[model samples]
Target: MPIHNADIAAIFEEIADLLEIQDANPFRVRAYRNAARTIGEYGREVAGLLANGEKLPKLPGIGADLAAKIEEIATTGRCRFLEQLRSQLPPTITQLLHIPGLGPKRVKMLYDSLQVQTLDQLARAAQAGRIRELPGFGEKTERAILEAIRAHASQERRYSIALATQYAEALIAHLRRAPGVKQAVVAGSYRRAKETVGDLDILVTARQGRPVMEHLMTYDEIADVLSHGDTRSSVVLRSGIQVDVRVLPPESYGAALHYFTGSKPHNIAIRKLGQERGLKINEYGVFRGDERIAGETEESVFAAVGLPWIPPELREDRGEIEAARAGRLPKLVELKDLRGDLHVHSKASDGRHGLRELAEEARRRGFQYLAITDHSPRLAVTHGLDAKRLSRQMDEIDRLNEELEDIRLLKGIEVDILEDGSLDLPDDVLGRLDLVVAAVHSHFNLPREQQTTRILRAMDHPHFTLLAHPSGREIGGRPPMDVDMERIIRHARERGCYLELNAQPERLDLTDLYCQMAKAEGVLVAIDSDAHTLLDFDHLRFGIGQARRGWLTAKDVLNTRTINTLLPLLKRTM
Candidate 1:
């Protein structure tokens, strides 16, 4: 089996979890976690690198030993250290870590006290009222664990866009290399750039002699082949994501893409339009009484219905068809439209890179500016900066800006929004920066009313410039906090403040709906990376996807403006 970067990352994460449960050294545990992150986010496949006899690039927190482990997993599809750790622990123990409120320590305590090794065991303990009797696991924590386990059992598995991309892009490349292949593309929600994808729909066009099904079945990552046919096949990857591949003739390529890329409602609406015109539309082509009218391309398919080509991101049947009919579809924001990133960090806080290195990397990516928004002091786990440290970092940013040529560093902070809604740093400190990116790092369980009020109060601060990751969601791991997002957006509009569409894979906060809501409210969003490492800057593309899905245009994005225009907007909040 060909081990993907994600596969290796998963092994490392499992190792980290097991080690943490064993009460291993904290630094050692952190190293494995960090290595997993770097490998998962890396653009290239580790196996490909190894195959080409290239040395893995030195990543932060990845020492020589951890690098060796990565190579082992990449080449052998297994890690010896992880296997050893698993031998010492129950296999189901790691699953406990997936429960939202259960950390390694809590799992360890439960196991020691009640011999809990699985969700079932934990649930029984909680129901028996034994969990609350444990030292750290009180009634509240016990109830939360039960709720998380229930939610986990009920929810369908969904992969984050970033992780799914790693799998989909790799498979697409693999298919393109097959003999007689003409075109290969991933359709469905993956093509639409959804924040989470349920599965992959792959469409391919090939010559008559091609062996597409054979090639797909041979993919190294295939965990099981669900079904196989000459023109269509379905398989499950080792990562648990199901993939369906279909082979079509060149003539029906566009129609097949449209059918597979559908939000079912959107396709139904288009088919109804065809029906009105006395035409039949299906995956193969659009026809008028058995005479094919359009099928070669998506544009033709749309034109057959007297509509323009709707961007795939806007194909949610959410007024997109109407807009297409009226010729008023938005020119959605693209990755290239961004001029800078407003939510970046450096080693001054929890970030991996130094100021100069981050600036050079941003400049290398053609960005004109990058903001260093390190965490404020309340987040002591990250060594977040105090006022004195923030002031010093501001001076450092000014000096670096003068020394650099193309990229300018903006002084900023990802200041914690206190429980009562006050800014982490004082106004005097916040006012000196180019922008202040405020975020709520704690108290995620506050009641909806209290959470909404907390954020609104934070926005009222004189120096508040932007709200970062406004929803505080962690994708599959944690749910969004209970808060009134509409109220928050309205407050932002009134106070001249901005909201952020944080691009980090796990926290693509301010979801597509919220993005649309902000757009409707006349509020501009900063599609920021919230980067903690140099590689994190690449996350902006994910943010752009979320923005496009929300029907955002360049004018609706804040950082799409030049530094001069952005500066005045920031000043207004100050």
Candidate 2:
């Protein structure tokens, strides 16, 4: 029986966090954590289906007890084991599960000795010297925790797929060129083009022994090397990143890559399909008896089981196999078809580059135009513009238009949508800007209904042009506000509002599904990188993937339009 998705995953995640806090086996914790992620990538309501007499743990990581909890979740919508484990502790302690270094052991010790659970309480304890007092926890460890907490607060958790892609490309380039390297490629969530990536994993083909071992020792960014086996290497980068690379023979490259590029559930389904067909698959190629048959590429692996090619991102074993067999794969969007970015900041606010410099950058990227959307006056922290300030910036853009040759700057403002569901500026103020990007700033804890109503009401405001990072999700740590994304997309379409594909790595907010639905419903998609710094600008490639995944075409993006064309569309927003 396949371990039902939710049960096995929940147990694994909790167990990993608990074990980490317990200071137990680091590898065991990592194994469970990785397994949970691999299983969760399968896009289905797993626990629910398992209740209907399904095999549990057929998915990877479904050891007996973990599999049983999946059955529990499927049957009852909750896991008893997780509930029991946390029963004596304050619920807020669970949040520590997310903070990088303080695993289950540290958490338990803090709870037992200090009777503290929430981060606020723990911070106070650390300041008071309670953290250092714990046996085995030194001043250095305590300082590290405090630093991680602060970093955890400021670091963008959700990166745009584009940013992750850049890092992957940078890292892979080096790994591929290492001595004895044959073939190397990125696998895992990055390969699937997920909105956020915790780390990047690359697999390689190489000769065994000293060639691979020596090359492992030469990795530039490895802050700490963890393993150096004959054909496998694991290292932690200076950025707190753990990268695992394995080497295999050229003949096994295809099968090994397939096995390693797992949304574990997807791989399990593929394995099961092979079994049903009297074949087998592993790090070795697909085989029937002693005869090797296929698997040098994912396409061949799938073909062997009578399935069509599935996009790496969609290989979640989420009925993808059945869909492919039925010849019903959804058409995904591509970068070439996307046209422009709707949200951006410049020197008019907190952005580093000035108008001309920014415009030229856009031109280099082959963009037709850029929207000089400085921060609105409400965000004083950003040196946002008042009406007088706004007028001056608009004038500069007007002058730049006459002088600049290639790209044009569209007058725009990233206005704050106040809590009252009204935009920060009055209609008269908004009327002056060529385009308005209405966004929510402060309140993230509003009820789901109220949050939806607030954004919807703002969209109804005639001056609103686009919505940026609609859900306000930051990535791994912050969960997206519980808005009805489907509703937002539908309403935006009917109201003639454009939903932005914020190209910023931290907020690929309008996900592929939302963009797809919007396109279907006649809503325009604006794939903007929302670049703040110069380095951030190149991240548009990942945003292009999101647009492609959402089925966006050049016609869907506003940046694809020449300045002459984009102006009228902004005018229509008013």
Candidate 3:
């Protein structure tokens, strides 16, 4: 089997979890966890580098030891360190970590105190009211564990877009290199840029001698070949994502891509249109009484149905077809349309780079401006800055502005919205910044009314410029806070404040639906990186994906404007 970066990363993550449960050195555990993160986010496959006899790039947090382990796992499809850790602990205990609110410490506590080794055992203990008797596991904790177990049991596994892209791109590259292969493209939700993908559908066109199916089976990453044939094949990658590849004639490639890249309802609706036009559409091609009409390209397929080619991101049966028919399809926001990032962090508050490095990187990326919204003191875990530290950082930013030539660094703070709906820093401190991004750092479990009111109150602050991660969600890990988002969006419009579409893969907050809601209300949304490190700036692409799906255009985004225009709009909030 070919070891994917995700596969190696998963092993390292498991090793870290087991080591933490065994009470290993904190630095040792951190090293493994950080290596996993670095490898998981890395753009290229580590195995490919090793295959070409190239030295692995020195990834962040990966030292010699971790790099050696990555090579070993890539070559052998197993991590001896993880295996050794499993020997010292119950391998099943690692599964407990999947339950929300259960960390390694709590898992260890459950194992030592109650012998809860599996989800079933933990669920039974919680139901029997035994978990509450354990130290730190109160009734609320026990109840939460039960709920998490239920949710986990019922949820289908989905891969994050970043991870999915790693696999999809590697596979596409491999297939394109196959002899006689004319074209290959990843379809389905991966092409649609969905936040999470259930699987990948690859459509390809090849000559008679190409044997794409055979080539797929030869891939190094195939963990299990479920089936293989002359024209179709299915396999599960080591990282647990299923891939299905279909070979089609060049004539039908476009129709096949359209058929498979569907949002089910969208495809059904399109087929209905075909029926109304006295045409039949399928993976084969668009036919009028067995006479192939159009299928050579996606545009031809759409044109056959009297509609313009809709962007895949908007093909969610969300009025896209109607818009296409009426020639009103939006020119969706693209990554290049962004003029700057409004929420960025530096070493002043838990970020990895300094002000100069951040500014240089932003300038290198062609951004006209970058906001240094370091965390406020309320988030102590991140060593968030107080007024004194923030003031000093502001002074440094001003000095850098004078030194730097191309990029302007705006002074800002990601101020915490306290439980009582108050801003973390005093008004005097907040008033001095170019922008104030209010966020809820704690108390995620507040009642919907309380959460909504708390956020509204914070937005009412005269200095408040934007709401960061308007919905406090962490994708699969944590659900969005119980807040009335409609009310929040309305209040933001009335207050002249903006909302954020945080680009971090884990927190694509202000979801696609909410982005449309904000747009509908005539409220500008800022697609921000909320970056803690330099590499995080690259995550803006994911935010752009979300915005495009929400039907956002350049005009609907706040950061698309130049600094001069953006400053005036931000001042309107003040």
Top lDDT hit: 1
Q: Candidate 2 lDDT, tens digit per residue, 1-574? A: 2333434555667766656665767756765665565454444446435556556435543466556655566566566656765674555777766665565777788888888788777778778878998988889888877876777778654444543554456568777767878778988777777776667677887766457667667765567988878777778765455678777777777787778777899999999999999999998799999998987776788899998878776776656678788997766556654455667788678676688778887777776777777888887767788878888888888998999886677788898988879987778878877789988886876899999999999999988999988888766655577788888988987887788888765577778788768877888878787866444556676777676656566776666666677778777878
The whole-model lDDT of each prediction reads 0.90, 0.73, 0.89
Off by over 4 Å in 1: 138-141
Q: Candidate 3: lDDT of 496? A: 85
Pick the TM-score winner. 1
Model 3, clash count?
1
Alpha carbon lDDT at 430, candidate 1: 89
The 10-residue segment with the lowest total lDDT in model 1:
207-216
Off by over 4 Å in 3: 19-32, 50-81, 138-140
For candidate 2, give the lDDT: 0.73
**TM-score for every candidate vs. truth?**
0.97, 0.69, 0.94
Report the lDDT of model 1 for residue 70: 88
* lDDT (10s digit) by residue, model 1, range 68-103: 998888888878888789889887899998898888
Task: Supply the global lDDT for candidate 1.
Answer: 0.90
lDDT of 1 at 210: 40
